[model samples]
Target: MHMADALISPAVAGTMYVCSAAAAGYSIKKVRMDTDTKKIPVMGIMGAFVFAAQMINFTIPGTGSSGHLCGGMLLSALLGPCAGFLTMIGVLLIQCLLFADGGLLALGCNVWNMAFYGCFIGALLIWRPMMKHSMTKKRIIISSILGCVLTLQLGAFSVSLETLASGITELPFLAFVATMQPIHLAIGLVEGCITAAVLVFVYEARPELLYAGEQANTRQNVFSFKKTLAILAITAAAIGGILSLFASSHPDGLEWSIEQLTGATELSASGGIYRMADTIQQATSILPDYAFSNSDSVFGTTFSGIFGGIVVIVLCVLVCRLFKFFSRKKSS
Candidate 1:
């Protein structure tokens, strides 16, 4: 769930921004220490895939809330937590600055809520433990489902807490929690199933990538990683360009929860800080809400999805390269 600028006060937002930036810095260090050059390309492609997948918000039955794939757990499952977190930063940055999908002031909060929990807590505590002994289909599915559900629950709770801390009295704490938790639970279930299917496909096609760090010199699955990457890239194109058009029109889990509690989809914010953030977002966002600024045509939607995906890919690669460059410089 992407938090809007109104959901948080300047103080709370600033604190979270520092915390997320610190986390991002630490992740960059960890990834740089990891000398796996192969992960760079995979991270870039998977980030693009995540950007595309998030465009198609699937409808949750009977809930009137739509949810898209967060892709943190998916990325962590393949790239490991450090690389996964860095990749998610790229995804969220593109969405914040270019697409205007999330607020600029709330960018740090969004990254913390969406990316941190999935990459660290879900991947390390749940998925890694579940898959440590065996990488079977059953284990993969179980881990994926459990990890996705846990991360979403944690993320939803964090959102409520942050909103309360921001002094937004429109949404009472207990009621807001009650509404947000259940809706995100439904959303998490769908995400888990989708994640499981993708992981299973990768496992069957290229199990080596999953265990690449463990078996450093394995050459048996060299071509499999590229094959899987190609498949994922094509899947991203299809989903973003076509399937995104069919996404549910209902509010997402966060907005739906706010509506249930406050009877309003958008909360009002008035302040110099709010205005500045809005102005900057307006100036930077070429496509707002994943559609063209001037038109809501299907072509605009399709183009936004495809173009966003490409932008994320380039950004992710650049991030990886930057880290790699510094890492090498330090070594030499």
Candidate 2:
């Protein structure tokens, strides 16, 4: 869930921001300095794929609520933990700035809550241990669902805890967590299935990708055509544009959770110091809460998803290409 700038306090947000930045920096270093650079293209394309997949949040059957793929552990399992972490950072950046999926000030917290645990912990703790006994379809599916559920559940709880710790909301700490976690549990199941599906596809068609990752020192370059990556990015952008049209007029997962618990959904954003910044952004953002009033629907959602996908893919590619180039230069 994209925590709005309104929901978080500067202290809590700033703390998480620092933590997220540190973790992201560490992840990049782990991947860049330690791992082979040939895998960069895979990381970039997969980052875009995650962006696109997130855009297509499928409505949970019979619930009238929706959830999207988070793609963290899946990326890690496929790409290794370090690359997955950096890829997630790239994805979150696209979502926050270009898509306005999450606010600029709140980006760090969002990244930490959503990406850090999933990429690092999910991969290192859950997936790796489980994969030792079995890489079977059943095992991968079960592990993915479990890992994703735990990750989202943890992140959602962190959001509740962070906001409560900040003393930003009148909501009680346990109360906020209670409100957030269950819905995300449901969301996590969806993520689990989607991740398993993608992983299964890759595993079946190209087990070499995962097998190669075991030899982390010698990941082969798979940069030819790879049209799937480009197609996925385009598809994700299109889904974002299309979904902006039908985004439940009702509050989303987090907002809905708050509403169900409190009997009211709207929280006042007036008290925080970030208010001025929020105001300036509100003024500039044509669709602050993702709605366009004056302009025709065409202007809505704009191309941010597509634009974001492009930015993420390009940045990832550049980072990867640089890693590859330099690695080659050193070896030569």
| TM-score of every candidate relative to the true structure | 0.95, 0.83
* Per-residue accuracy of model 1 over 104-213 as CA lDDT, tens digit each: 99999999999999999988998888776656778888988999999999999999999999995578999999999999998999999999998887786777667322
Compute the lDDT of residue 19 as modeled in candidate 1: 90
For all candidates in order, the CA lDDT equals 0.86, 0.70
lDDT of 2 by residue, 1-332 (tens): 77777777777778888998888777766665554554666777678778767766566565556766778887888777778888888887766644457766777888888888788778888888877754667777887899999999888888887777777667777777776787788889888988888777666545545523343323333432355445544555665566545544445567777776667765666655677656655555544433354555555554544555667779988876665422533344
Error of 2 at 71 (Å): 2.2
Best candidate, lDDT-wise?
1
Clashes of each: 0, 1
- Model 1 residue runs over 4 Å out of place are 211-223, 325-332
Q: How much is the lDDT of residue 152 in candidate 1?
A: 96
Give the C-alpha lDDT of model 1: 0.86
Least well predicted 10-residue stretch by lDDT in candidate 1 = 211-220
